[model samples]
Target: MDEHPEPGHDPAVGALDPRAELSEFLRTRRARLKPEDVGLRSFGRYRRVPGLRREELAQLAGVSAAYYTRLEQGNGRHVSAEVLDAIARALRLSDAEHAHLTHLAKPKQHKKKPAVRTQQVSGPLRTLLDTMDGVPASIVGRRSDILAWNRMAAAVFGNWAELPAQEQNWVRLVFLRPEYRDLFADWERKANDVVCQLRLDAGSHPHDPQLSALVGELSVKSEDFRRLWATRDVTVKCNGVQRLHHPLVGELDLRVESFHLADDHEQMLLTSHAEPGSPSAEALRLLASWGTDATTAGAGTPPTRTA
Candidate 1:
């Protein structure tokens, strides 16, 4: 046994029970839908259960009530793909959500001992980060870890390179750190996005002990995280505009873009760029020029004199 486990791998975090996860995911999805939302007539009848009843969902998905009930109970053994698709349609799940559903219903076989390797940034990838001068770019691992970043990223975002390895996760930063809450103009949106991404990861890697630990820590520390996690919403924000409030720069509206590495799908290259000739672009240039000094100033620390 590797005495020193990976940073996110806490023995006490406890492995996630996939069956329980599936049940909760199904329950939450079903709870969010109403009878009329799926074109079913409610007839103003008093309803005990929120959203669509199991029987109603079964009818919409063209499955038997008992069958849907069994699947929802986390017993997805021998479930057909077509039936899963029908259920997803009935739930009106997004593409990401549908994928999550599939993963939950038919998880891959787990090894007796799950791998606990630490993720690393390839040298070429590091060089690539350095070459992206104006664009703030970072390489994020599958577990949302900040594996590597460029100077521009440190200048525009916080100085991630200076932080301890374990603290370099997106979910932890968004939920556990007050600074991040202040950094995003719309903190709630950012929180939702991070949680949704985590949800997607959860469905795919239900047996990941590190992920289970991260979820456990976040759920205990953040009421908002607990609320968002319970929603079971899943999404991957590939392209979007993020509003930010930087300490040095007044305000910035940057276009965020993410691309999965061709060779390693588990790693994603995320970059943010401002529109050409925009004030945000000018701010980025200033930060780039100042570089480490700007990072120092951003932290409200006076530059040291070295004569």
Candidate 2:
């Protein structure tokens, strides 16, 4: 064998284990949720497990105990579609969560390695991506490539665009590279965001070789990443606050939102505010105007220098 099976080092800043991922997701989803959350209840004052017991859930899903256990253990292969549907309903899975379940239940079928969904932008999605005048937005596929970006978005995350096509994963930069720590005002919050997003991807695409490899690489690299990855939290990425530590203009509190095009696949819109004539917003405007990519269609220009 060559000196190293995979030459380049991933530093393992943060990584996820699919088996553990599936187990945690199932356990937590089963816990924390009150019976009232799903219209189930127990009479006596005694309950051994939190949330619904494993057997109770199996009953609700119309599955056998051993089967559901295997599913939660991430060892169940070739699960039936009907059982999956039952589990989805019993778990009270959201649309995104449901899609993720199916991905796990079914083995991935692809000839060449799939490109993590960087392509396949829908018409309405393209239109929405184009119209965002202020926020810097970009659509990231399952592998987290910066596929398409709006003008302001490009500026805010300029460094990502400047990177070679292959090196644009946000998680890679955050944990493996020192620059990631400097870019966010609240490192914990931003780190949490990264971890949560990665968790979501892990659940949705368990069989993606590249995705698995990327995550495995990160897990071995960074202790901080590993710790956060262990939290096992996932998000739908609908809306959130992002704190930015700009190398040029201090910090800007941004409102970030995500809208999905094809179910779980979506684009993120990152916008900063300047009160009509406020200094920060002014800075934002100046940032976009300074070195904006005017020719790029949907993404017009950055509110600031693309860093």
Candidate 3:
């Protein structure tokens, strides 16, 4: 990755321009829906646009084309909730997408000053992570930064503790590091999930400079990141399954769960574990015995015990 910012990048802090973001998001959403998909007839033989036209979408949403056009142009300062709901229905948006639209249209008032403090893991949370013996767990802060991680997490995901503070981000690790690209069995799917989660975060906190900077950096460095970020997908990370190819362990399918911290919603406790009595479970057992050294163990190293 280049240490210098890409040419034309603002030297100040990074932030998604709300108006531009809203316009692009609405355009993409509208482009994904066809007239037939929404039970509308195609009146013309050769449609100029990819999906439904602006007027057609406005008609479907039960609003004037002028009003819808204004909204789509990112002038949603006076847009009503009922109208937004109608538009969301017309676009066939998911719950997450609907929320993202709402956030874009009706952004919260931010403080005059920008946030600068770094997130920290509390001592109690650190203790909790340490006590979660066999589970691979980590506390992730904004931009998927690995704030704190346990021994199992180090063994499974590599030692984040050894990385520089700014380099301990999931996006950075997954896109910038070749090892992580090989680590995930389904690299494309995992990349989409990571970008979607970041999109959701971007919508919720559009004024976050650090997040904007992270996005800018990734966009400059990784073509895959640039492609995925443009999709405008949004999703809340609750639970999922990830297949990993650990260097020490051959292959492991782990259930991934994320729980947002009650007091600090910006932070989440992420854990990955395998099923009981499975080969993956046995693999975890072996890694636990090897401890943090499992990260340094070469992929070709002979297994001390059979799974």
**lDDT by residue for model 2 over 93-165, one digit each (tens)?**
8776676667656746668645654355567766776687665677776656566766676656554556777
Candidate ranking under TM-score, highest first, comes to: 1, 3, 2
lDDT measured at residue 11 in model 2 versus the true structure, 0 to 100 = 27
What would the per-residue lDDT of candidate 3 be over residues 1-307, giving only the tens digit for each residue?
5444323234255657788788888898999988889898776668788889999999999999999998888876778899999999999999999999998899888667567567999999999999999899999887878899999998899888788989999989989999998899999988888899888887888878888898888877888887888778887765888899877768999999999999999899999999999999999998888875686766676445423
lDDT of 1 by residue, 128-219 (tens): 99999989999998669999999899877788867888899999999888989889999999999889998888888877778888887776
lDDT accuracy of residue 130 in candidate 1: 96
Task: Estimate every model's Cα lDDT from 0 to 1.
Answer: 0.84, 0.65, 0.85
- Candidate 3: lDDT of 40? 83
After TM-score superposition, what is the CA distance of residue 281 in candidate 3 from its true location, in Å? 0.4
Give the Cα-based TM-score of candidate 3 against the true structure: 0.92
Q: Note the residue pairs that clash in candidate 3.
A: none
Question: Model 2 reaches what TM-score against the true structure?
Answer: 0.67
Q: Per-prediction TM-score, please?
A: 0.92, 0.67, 0.92
Global Cα lDDT for candidate 2: 0.65
